[model samples]
Target: SWLLQVGPEGYIVLPSAGTLEVAGRTLADVRLDVLHRLSALFRGVNIDVRLGRPRTFRIYLTGQVKAPGALQVTGSPRVSDILNSAALQDNASRRHIQVVHPDGSRELTDVERFVRIGDQSMNPWLRDGDVLQVPVANEFVWAEGAFGRPGQIELGLNDSLLTLFRLAGDPLPAAEVGNVLMLHWKDPFKPDSTWLRLDDVYRGTTNPPLRDGDRIYVYYIPQYHLQHEATVVGEVERPGTYPIAEGRNRISDLVKAAHGFLPTADLTSIRVHRLNPGAGEKDPELDRLLRLSRDQLTASEYVKLTTKLSSLREDYRIDWARLQESPKDLDLLLKDGDVVRVERLVPSIRIDGEVRHPGILTFQRGLRIQDYVQQAGGFTDRAWASRIRVTRVVTGQTLPARNVRALDPGDFVWIPERPDKTAWDDSREILTALAQVATVLIAIKSVK
Candidate 1:
């Protein structure tokens, strides 16, 4: 043997046995062939051979490939490894890549199968001096509605509806499989549609062949995935989520379904928190007015600001006592995601800020704002008495004491300490109250 080694050209020169082609062939297969030829020449002794280093060579990449030309790869690479080096265009055919061998025989590889289904068989090892022809993809199909991965997919020549659906992931539970809409273009100018039963296709039924630019829409069943439920907690007998028919279910109906309120249920201050209330588009006029100081606002703008604030989603409270008095006018229609919190009876009013003794006072139906303020040691000398506000605990509605005549049991009477507070400070305080109370929309008009 003439100092044999696996050269760049991938062959070994034997003095008497001649040359042998080894590149792209399996190392184990090449080892067997080498040993067989050499064994004939050198007999009566055991022959041992092992690969010292992996072989690397250049492979030609042409057609529908980015940076098309010879791409250098090393060490017994597969079709996928070479593909990684030669980035193919989006229009390149991933399902029918031709790997043309040096001897002119070619093998078809499916990169899509290897990627989507993890089918290793579809990805074959590369041969040296092989030419990869990444043809332009011509077929395409689309899938949408009630599908996990709903989008357009590159199609192969023999790909069927089943193949497209399989690549899209399993249909959602709400998918109306029997009525899956299939739209295709029979006439070049117009499109036609038909329904296919996907369940049958999954079975023994022949999967329909897909045409170019076909669309499959798997629609969802009506109300199949919808959940219309609300929560009832606190002093309610059953504190859990219950389904409601929305418009048909009233506050009383929901309460009755919860096995009525508990004995401690505060009938005078039952609160209903509508979780998903629609917040309308931002009002630029209202926004501009709010940013200005109270003195900067015109009389007409002040009126506008007050009117806009009133139209906002209010703090909703269902007084069982008031509803019982006038059921027709007071009964509220329950909505989805409404939280009916039946608080334990606490016949006490909270008197906070600027009060001599800020604390809870006994609730009396006849007591006015002044009456409660007097019981809580009255306002301090620094108190902004005109700006004193009563915040409805259930609805966070803070109003001037003059606007409120009699106070309820779960009410917060805040007496502000007189200050040269900026509009930003008052606005920030009002925003804090809104977040904490859930729907508090008190006007911050005391800008100094």
Candidate 2:
């Protein structure tokens, strides 16, 4: 007589239908848990099924997408359909549809228009949705330098996609092609990758289908008209002012653009002496030292001199000794307007106190710290061997007597108090005091 019954273990029993137990899965577990808690409160003759399959698909609209956050989709759909249903973008270019596949590859579909309304003979040079554009035809061009062009007419196509005719004015300056620009399209109707030069594009290069919402950019390459004005001085084959184009020139390029340096020229010492714009307001102090003629310097020269002085006080510095030891220092990036002076290397060190020839001796390149000591006259009779210390003035770093480190610029060699080993006890006492002093000095120096 009962249409349905409740089982003790949270299950639904139907007299006509088969028994359905809460199988501890999906809604079953929830139903069982819920019913098990409320079983005593309800004595029901009919069973109620509370849960079933959801009616929505999980979707997330984000980024430039109009609809954002978690969303639900109902029924089968395509990407276009989903976008439309969600109103994803306001200005979405249907022609530029970009679909991201599950495997992460992207599909770019560009829509093109070929045929026009009254097009006959298959619309000679256009496809559907493509706009007809008027072409600019001209047979003459003008530019400067060795040669110039008055006008030149274009003939039928040759093997070349485009041909550049010399314009009348001056012979085309070497490497200076005048007014050549290129236009680029972001999206073309055809699914091929082909580009045309500006001259050709303006001249109706191809009949490729043009699409809606496509963009084109124009780039120009001006001939080096200024080549005759640019000059390379110091260490170059032709060291003088040479002309170059306005923009097609750089220091490095100009170096190669010219014949390069002579065999005697020092490449590392080469520098650009630009016209100093501020040189007219000469400082009396600087002019006295440089003794450069007024005509020889420009405003830029004075400014550079001032800057060099400033750098000499600060950044333009090198602890040649440290640099020699640490090769990394040599890799410093040189800045424009920087005057790199490669002074002749004069190796020398000062040895004070003790030794026979106790004066400053000129040291040669690759001279060691010991060489300087020997030059300082190899210690007086009372000179203490272990008491020697090399003090670096620039870094304030001091090396001990026994440390065989190389001598650096601004370093002073100090030969300390002697250690007399004539008597065993006296020598021991002196050595102990010296060792104690060295240890204390090292410890005190550590905090620095």
- Which candidate achieves the best TM-score against the true structure? 1
Per-residue lDDT of 28 in model 1: 89
lDDT of 2 by residue, 1-448 (tens): 2333334454766433445665334666656654554455556734455643323445444444565565556533334444442453444432233444434554432211111112122222111121211112222212222333423222211212222221122223342233332222454443333444433433655333333222222223353332335555555555555445444445555556557645654333333334344545556767564777756778988777667555444223343345446645442333333332222333456678666676667756577656776766576778777778887544455788567456654467877767555688888999999999999999999977
lDDT per residue for candidate 1 within 1-448, as digits (tens), equals 2346776677877556888988668778977987899889989978766766665778999988898899788887788876752588867888789999999998888887677767777688887789999888877899989887889888875878888887787588888868888898897779998878978879848478888888999999888957788788899888888988878888888888889988888887888877534446688888998998999999998999888877775347788988999988888888888888888988889999998999988898887888878988888889999899889776678999888877777899999999877999999999997786653333343331
- Enumerate residue pairs that collide in model 1: none
Query: In model 1, how large is the Cα lDDT of residue 335?
Result: 84
Candidate No. with top lDDT: 1
Clash number for model 1? Answer: 0
